[model samples]
Target: MSFFNLFTQKSSSKISDKKLKEMLESSTPPLLIDVRTPEEYSRGHISKSKNIPVQNFEDSIKKMGLKLDSPIVVYCQSGMRASQASKILNKLGFEEIYNLGGIGNWSYGLKR
Candidate 1:
């Protein structure tokens, strides 16, 4: 691997929408976050997914009152932003972070 790759590694953890739903239904659910624009989130988003725009991800997470090791699942309009957010979460000491990809990939419906 390149030297750059060693410093900027992406997380490998990802989950499908069905798995996300199942996890949500569990007694201990992961912290679901929508890393999309506020306007996009206002249009529609996954139920119980908090809108934390990717631009200010760190600040948003700090205000969420979550622990450093909280199980967090992040998504966006597409998978790109979620991937970036997952990297940030990993660096911030979040032990369990999962990228749920895009809301478009969600087959279980959304909340408007």
Candidate 2:
């Protein structure tokens, strides 16, 4: 089965950045999603991460070109936006969704 297949199953695992980093280092790295506004995302984000911006998430998911089954790791400037985005993704039927809480907790650093 491919990574996309994972989304078909239900995921109950919620992870932290330290655990998320470990997965990135040892396992398949989930899709790191930044759910802040575009301006906030442009300011800085985890390296190689994609910006979806919570305000436009429902309409922009397809445009974001994210793999449906890919393990999703979402984050925001604080934690609120990402929390909202997480619920949205879940309703969209994405399995294996994980929220990284917020950018403030990212220690590996960010990029513009």
Candidate 3:
């Protein structure tokens, strides 16, 4: 891997939309996070998602009092920010992190 790949690389788990939808409806839904700016998130975001911008990602996650093993789902307007947040989550020892990529790719209803 090149040196720059460290910054651009993504986490291992990239979930399919259908699987994510099912997870959302299941009894134990993952902790969903929107790594977009508050204003962009205000426009529209996935239901059950919390807005935690990538820059503040680690601090916000720490404040949430979540467990290290809790399942987490993260997304952004585009996949880039989500990837960044996912890396932070991994470094923070979160075990089940899933990057759902771009919100624009989501086929389900968004919360306004």
Candidate 4:
């Protein structure tokens, strides 16, 4: 890896399901993001999560008005899509980002 790649700060933070759940239960929850398609999101998603289809992530982020230091939790049906989205957000300068793996580990009930 290049010196920059090795020494540069990570684009996003990563958290496990348990830690994410705890944060969600706290008084203030992180900005939960579901990077799945609309159809997939409609099937079920974590409450309070904003659905931004992977295809439109770049476009959607522009309107979010979120700070780079804000904590963001991203997830998808199986984890692949969320992984890509996490990387994209990191590249865009979002600092505190967490890839919550997948919706499969969500202990809380779904919204839909």
User: Over 4 Å off in model 4, which ranges?
Assistant: 1-7
Q: How accurate is candidate 3 locally (lDDT)?
A: 0.87
Rate residue 13 of model 4 by lDDT: 59
State each model's CA lDDT, in order: 0.86, 0.79, 0.87, 0.84
State the weakest 10-residue window (summed lDDT) of model 4: 1-10
Q: Tens-digit lDDT track for model 3 on 24-103? A: 89999999899999999999999888889998888889998998778899999889999998889877667789999999
- In order of appearance, the predictions have TM-scores of 0.86, 0.78, 0.87, 0.86
lDDT tens readout by residue for model 1, 1-112: 4566567655649898889999999999988999999999999999999889999998878777788667899999889999989988877667688998888888988899
Strongest candidate by TM-score:
3
lDDT of 4 by residue, 1-112 (tens): 3567545647655677789888988997898999998998999888889999888997788788888778889999888888989888877777788998789978868999
51: Cα error in model 1, Å:
0.2
After superposition, the stretches of candidate 3 with alpha carbons farther than 4 Å from their true spots are 1-10
Q: Write the per-residue lDDT of candidate 2 for residues 55-97, one digit (tens) a residue.
A: 8888888666767677888888878888888888877777678
Winning candidate number (lDDT): 3
CA-RMSD of model 4: 3.0
Each prediction's number of clashing residue pairs: 0, 0, 0, 0
